[model samples]
Target: MAARETTNARTLTIALAQYAQLELSDPSAFDHFCQSVRSICEASARDGKKIDLLAFPEMHLFGTGTAGEDEANQAQLDAAVDIPQSNGGETEFIADSLPARCAELAKELGIWLIPGTFCERNPEGGIYNTAAVFSPSGELSGSYRKICPWRPYERYTPGDSFTVIDIPGKGRLGLTVCYDAWFPELSRQVAWLGADIIVNLVRTTTPDRRQELVLARATAITNQVFVASVNAAAPQGVGQSLLVDPEGEILHDSEGSDEELLIDTIDLDAVSRVRRIGTAGSNRLWEQFRPDDPEIPLPLYEGHIKPLRWQPQQH
Candidate 1:
């Protein structure tokens, strides 16, 4: 008699790790950071609560400040690492070491890992803030770049690709970095590419931007995709890590103080249901509005930029 094969329906229990570690300038600091992440994942696993995905904060390994720029951009260069190309044979050499370490960790835990933006050296040797996905099989799944460059990121190169990755029965996953969450258009584009979930790993300093985070939820409803955001706790960004559902419901969140794990069970079927039904509480046609008309430029004139100079003189 031949043995029968069985198919297993896949479901994921995601854990958004909120850490409060101090950002360090020393490259040696990554060892401790890796240890912390491993300990958290392993502890959670031992509790019979296996974390399918662990989302870390943006610039979680190193600090987020720009330093030593006047001297030939050495600060950014110092943090930058050449992925898969570093001369050092140590798998833990440079920033690439973090992702490699996470991959190995994920394989050991049999879970997926999503570490937010790390400095990457491009093929041309220029630096870019990049995010990488590691599979439980210990393989690099997909990598994404921060689309919107804020502050010191103006000099960093932008990525031209929008990739949607498949995660077994979890539907398609979309990747975007820090500032990318600010643009609704980016989320729309990610949705149009058929992603069921859009994950944003961010580092923000302004806590008053709760409205902006709410706007992220609105974007999720409009795009009919679940939004999972992971951010660092204290001394880093706004520190509000959240998970917003396709219906604009806040599934989970964390305040700035606790080094917490906000876990949520995502229903992969909700993507198409909410989009197609568009019934009572799920309308999303507002997404069809276009503002690209040449005549629709802001300020209605040049007054927007130099408003103080262009102000109407005392009448």
Candidate 2:
């Protein structure tokens, strides 16, 4: 039998794929990878643990095809695919494309899927590191392009907006890619948009991954939302993927730089609980701001944090 769909909105089982990058240069290699994902879902089903959502690391689709950084960058550029823009209109996916394949996989496994970040070629010019979300029924739920690409190393064009998708049984999920987590504003804006869970896709081979774990916990605590940060395995990445609860507690961690599947069932209602009572029943950050509060000037971005507009919708 296929994996069962999540019926309860209060809780959700998620699978984080912490695997090494593969040279998916051809269709057969890509199919093999897809099959591996299917096998995992099937195994979970046999164990009576159906995963509601499965997420992979950033650039999981783009493997290091060459030895040098420049060559690897060029390989990603060469393998970049086109994604249709959703400008308040019906967004279509090209048949047999990476996104379409991911949709098919999601439908096949009967679960939500995030097949990691894809190198997307823009119609006008340049490329973006993008992540696509697919629902169980093979529909393109949403997609998020990386807003903050690692400077001086990554050549991706930054995305201008944040993306949040509402899962029927699960709560609203926000998307962030790699270095985007470094910027707290991104997570704050996403949380302000009514996201109960924030998913951060990362592919950091550098030692800075240690700091990312801290950021993940901080993001969850400040936003009062669950945070799932998935990273690539060692050699390709630092492989310290983790899940942080709304209370800023690390529920699960991959531990070291090894390929492993980190599975956990999270209480979605924990978001509402934390936001309602405050983290540890002490600091009510969200409730602290009032309607009469003054707007704080942000000279760096040439903007102000208006209290009136800063009120996030209660989950």
Candidate 3:
């Protein structure tokens, strides 16, 4: 006989993990981070809801700091993680190693995880910002290196691919790093590839936080997909991680810049519906989730766009 799906099973209970200011560099730091994640998952399970996906901030493994270009870049390179090879042969069995012990914790806690972003060292003496997803069985489900680096200061090479992972029984998952959210075309690319949920791991400075927040919502609204974003806490960023629904409504919002977890159960089925607000949401029109026509390409200048620069000292 086949098993039946439960009501709560269809809904994904996602945990947005903010850094408790934890940075992973060695086995002990990795172990502690996983321990904290285990605690959260265990507690959430006790509430009769299981956390299907747990996402960390973009720089949770590197922490926050102010250092010279060389020192800063070197710090990230030193923290870069890789998969271990065995038997002194090129035939690889397991590709990932510890210190960023995501596979270990996922297997131990029996939950899926995205270990956020870290600096990835290329064999030819370059580094790229990378992130990964692990299955409950401790297998590498998907891996992504950021295509756009934060420029001169970041000192990382850009990856040349897109990664959208398939989660069985759930929906396709897409990964995007901090600056990647600024590009609407990037979101469109991921959505066109059948991503139901796009997870953005972000770290922003205080000055540009408001603008970044707006971009986060804009990405979800434009693509009509669920976005679960995790921003670094406190000194790294504002810690205002947001979970936006397809309709561009805020489902879960974190107000403080501190270590915390925002857990919410969202209905993925709603991704296919066009929301119509009636009487302040008292009535809703459920139209087919058809995307906007591509006939009128976005490149065409529309008057609806805001001015990018200040007018020349007005007349």
For 1-315, candidate 3 gives per-residue lDDT tens digits of 012233544467789987745553354666677677888988999998899889998867675365667876777777766643222223232334542356767878787888777676788887778887877776677778887777655777898888788777777788889888877767767776767789998876566767777887787776667898888888667888889887677889888788789999877655543333321243232232224422332354442222322111110
How displaced is residue 29 in candidate 1, in Å?
2.8
lDDT of 3 at 15: 94
Using Cα atoms with residue i matched to residue i, what is each candidate's TM-score against the true structure?
0.77, 0.93, 0.79
* Model 2 lDDT at residue 230: 96
Cα lDDT of model 1 by residue, 1-315, tens digit? 011122332346788887754455665666776676678777887888778788888767657354444542455556676545222223332444666776777787777887666778776866777887777887777777777877663566887777667787667788887778877868877877778788888776676457667877887877777888887777666677898877778888887656787877666666655655652444745333334423333464443223222211110
Best by TM-score: 2
How many backbone clashes does every candidate have? 2, 0, 1
Pairs with backbone N, CA or C atoms under 3 Å apart (clashes), candidate 2: none
Error of 3 at 105 (Å): 1.2
Show where candidate 3 strays beyond 4 Å: 1-9, 24-27, 64-66, 83-96, 275-315
lDDT of 1: 0.68
List clashing residue pairs in candidate 3.
83-95
Sort every candidate by lDDT, greatest first. Answer: 2, 3, 1
The digit string of per-residue lDDT tens for model 2 on 1-315 reads: 112234544778999999887775665767777887998898898989999999999988788745587787778888899876655434478988888788788888889999888899977777899998888888888889999999998888999998998887668899999899999999999999999899999999897988999999999988888999999997788899999998889989997989999999887877776776767877777787788989899999999988888767654
**Candidate 2 total steric clashes:** 0
